[model samples]
Structure formats: C-alpha cells, structure tokens
Target: MTTKTIREIALAWKSDKQRYVKQSTYAAYVLILENHLLPSFGDYDSLSEKLVQEFVLQKLENGLSVKTVKDILIVLKMVMKFGVKNEWMNYCEWDIKYPTSETNKDLEVLTIAHHKKILDFIKENFTFRNLGIYISLTTGLRIGEICGLKWSDIDVCNETITVRRTIERIYMVEGDCKHTELVINTPKTKNSCREIPMNKELLAMVKPLKKVVNNEFYVLTNEEKPTEPRTYRNYYHRLMKRLEIPRLKYHGLRHSFATRCIESNCDYKTVSVLLGHANITTTLNLYVHPNMEQKKRCITKMLKSLRK
Candidate 1:
C-alpha cells in the first residue's frame, strides 16, 4: 500500500466512518481535523507523543483557550489512532490530556425568577413558542431533541416521548436540509435516544400544538414540516430582545432546566437520565451539583437530626 499524508489518512477515516455516525458529529470531526489538526501536523506521517504535547503548548501560547485546544488535541489523537490502524504509522502514546478547567465548576444557570420572566415574555409575545420552550425548560431536552421531535415520538396516552433523532445546525456546503438549511442529524449517542415522561402542562401545551399540526410532528414548519433550529434561534433571540431580558444563548434554557431540577431537590441520577446524559458524572460536571446554599441546607438538616 502506498503511504499517505496525514491529511489523506484523516480524510479517508472520515469518509469510511461517515455512514456509521450522525452527520452533525461527522461535521464536527471534519472541522476539528481540517481546521486544527492537519494544519499543524500535516507534514508528518506520524507524530511523537512529545511532539504532540509541544504542539498543544504552542496552541495554548498562541492564545487558544485551553478548552478549544483540548478539543483540537482530541481530534488529533483520533486521527493518529486512525493512521495507526491503517498501518500508515506505528503505535504512538496518546499523551494529550484535557486540561481541567475551573470554569466547569458550576454552570451559570437561569434563576427561577428569570425562568418565570422568560416564560411570561414568551406567553405574552409568542404563544406558539411556548410549547417548545416549556418542554425544554421542564424536561431538560436538548434543543436538537426538541426540534427533531415528531408526533409519533410523543405518547400522550402513555405520557412519554421517545427521543430518537436530533435536529442540529451543520454547515453543509450545499443546501439539503430545507427546514433549516443546516444539516439535521440523529442524536449524538445511544443514551441520548431516551424516553422522557411528559408533564401535565407540557402535555396540555403539546395537545393544542398537535391539533394545529393535524397529527404531524409536534413541532413543524408552516406546511407541517419539521421546524429548523435556525428559525427557532431567530425567534428565541427576537423574543429575548423584545422582553429586555438578559441575552443568553438558547442553550441556556437547558441549563436553566437542570438548575431548576437540582433546586427542586431532584437527584443527579434522575436529572442525568432526564437530560439523556451518558452518565451521572456528566450531569454533575456540566450542571451545578450542589451549590453553597444547598450544601448549607444539607448541613443544617444534618445538625437538626443530630440534635434530635
């Protein structure tokens, strides 16, 4: 077999694995490889562990945040493994480890008051937007999961919704996804494909929304097609601006839901399952686990028990 360049090997791996993964994930892997990995180590057929570490340090020096550089390094490691499997390069130690960032200590989640304000604003200004936001805020569903939702996925009779697909905004060179113009893809992982119970309020909201759809997707386009993430983002942004509320990314809604769940004394494992997180550790790491207030309350309750 003829030896191939790092770029060629990376592209081959991507092409071979494209069918096995969701388009959104493939796009992310392609982006990291194209923009970060190949540019730095394209000349080398195989990289040394020490060399890879040095490259990571240089990226950090070049003003790349540790988080971004960490993601880039992960992509490099994947490509290197691909090269090794293809016999383009010998086995090399995977040395680059993601740096621990303190920023992940606690998520900046929306407060209950803020949640109420946002909900009120949506109800007053855009009643149609209410169902989607309500479901996300209540169930902690990812934006893509909510957007990819179909009527068939929702079981009003059972009060559960099956999360099978996810609608994400992927940058495709050509326009294929008509609803969003961004590539819509499946859920990222098997765990992401979960079944969550529907709250009574969410059920009520969806019932009317489904009536409008005439038994199509719970969320759809004007002609009853699936609603796109881009359109929802635009509407969400407009709603935020009009309401004069703090402009947080639409993703903040999911964070808000997680925060509210924790505050309501919901356990981490349950929240993790609700969020479709791969594990409880991910839920604890990404969402606020136990804030100072919660800690104090726990201590106080324990002391009361001791006194008793």
Candidate 2:
C-alpha cells in the first residue's frame, strides 16, 4: 500500500490551518505534531488503528499520566480528522481509550488562614512579586495571562483588566541546538480574550505598580521582557519556603482563586469569564468543587424547598 509520511501530511495539515486559524494555534499544532506526534507515528501507516491503540496502551503502561496521554490523543485525533476532511486519507473506527486518573484526595486548596498567611508574608516581604501574587489571588488570571499583562491593558479608573495576551515559552529549533525563549502572544481562545473587573484592594495595588513599571513591557517581568513561566514557579517556591507554607503548584493560585470565588457566592459565569475559560461548563467542572460549607448550603436550600 502506498502511504505518505506522517510528517509530510502533518505539515500539510498545519499549513492548511494557518490559512484560516489563529497564528498561535497553528504554531501550537505544528509544534505538537513535530515534537510529539511525528516522532511516534511518522513511520507507521496513517490508516492503522492497531498502531494507534498500541501506542495509547503503551503510554499507559509506561506510566504516562492520563492527562498527558489524553492531550496527545487529542492532537492525533485532530490530524486524523483533518486528513479525512481533505481526502488525504480515510480511516474511521479508530478509538483511543485513556485510562482514568487516580483520585488525588490530597489536592491542595488554600484555607482562609493559609491564604492570609501567604498574603501577609508577601506584604511584609515587599518583594517585586507581591503584586503578582495579589492580583492572581484576587482575579483568578491564568499564569500565562498574568505574565502577559501590561500597564496598557489596565484601566485604573474603570477598575478592570483586559486579558488580551499570554506569555509562553517555546523551545526554538536552531540548526544543532534547541533553546527555549519567552514569547508574548494573544490569548489561547476568543473566550480567553476578556475583561475582568477588579476589586478595590487590587485596584489600589496595581494602579501604583503600573506607574513604576515600564509602560511598554509586561507587568511581571522586571527586565521589560516576557517572564519565563519556570522562573515564576521558582519565585513562588522560594516564597513558600520563606513563609513556611506548604508547597503547591504555581497554578494552585488560579484554583485557589476560583474556589474562593465560588465559596464567596460569586456567579459561575462571572468566575468563568474571570478565569478566561472557553466555556462555563469547563469552569463548573474544574472550579465549582464543593467544600463542606458549600455542601451544607446546598442541603439547607434543598430542605427549605420541601417546606413549600
């Protein structure tokens, strides 16, 4: 059977998307195809479900996390779908069953006391990163979005922040050596490009910080360049160590903000837009997790309805 190389077809597919899709998205598709997909499937027949299933199972057996495997499958599925639509190939009936992720009961959520302690630590330390921590906790901005923020996107009088871009790091493929570089690009989706109203305290803090920061550069980067995501992670780690607080992923700030918003009785759609999620359902699934207080409130509301 005559078959085209997966690399060639994937490039063709990427080029086709570049014609109509967002540049950042098209770039992501090309990167994932080159770095992850083609490396695994380039030599195989594009129509082989057996190879795809074996690859999925092998990934699971090799202890690749379920989320990672699911993401990979998503990319592969896109390429295959594109192939079918363009008549480059036709292979229906292919399926990838990703195993369930084990429940992590100990997933960290900051209590009010813990949140206060961290905030107080930041206040007393007077570090350059204080505003970042404050804004993230108050606003639920994704790390990339926060890092991408600039003074120009902020409106002091209006008390709002416009989320128009994201800071990302990509490994640049040079002739012989690969090096990572920080880049600023538009937000990941149309839904992610949004505006969020700021609370009073955040407004007071950011207004002054904006004055001191370079007007043309990102808010978080001290050198007027895009902030490396890993550097921010390290800074958070150091902050945790100094405060004697338990370590959580830098992304935990985003989750903590969302969880706090729900507990404080903020609306789901509001929280969804604040977090720049593409859909309210995604926000509900991820951030509307019920704590004991929330569960108790639900029960009370249900029981009260019975009185009628």
Best by lDDT: 2
The regions of model 1 sitting more than 4 angstroms off are: 1-4, 97-106, 121-126, 173-181, 208-212, 218-222, 297-308
Worst 10 residues of 2 by lDDT: 171-180
Candidates in order, TM-scores: namely: 0.84, 0.86
* Candidate 1, pairs of clashing residues: none
Candidate 2: pairs in clash:
none
> Number of clashes in model 2?
0
Q: In candidate 2, what are the lDDT values of residues 92-184, reduced to their tens digit?
A: 577666665666445467878888788766656665566677777877777888788887888887889898888777665433575666777
Residue-level lDDT of model 1, residues 1-308, one tens digit each, is 45677888887888787888777776778767766787887888778878888888787778788878877877777777887877887667755754555354355567678788876655554455556777777777787777877777777778888888888777542223322136556687778888899877667656665555555544544235667777888877786777677787888898888888877878889889888888888887776556688789999999999998
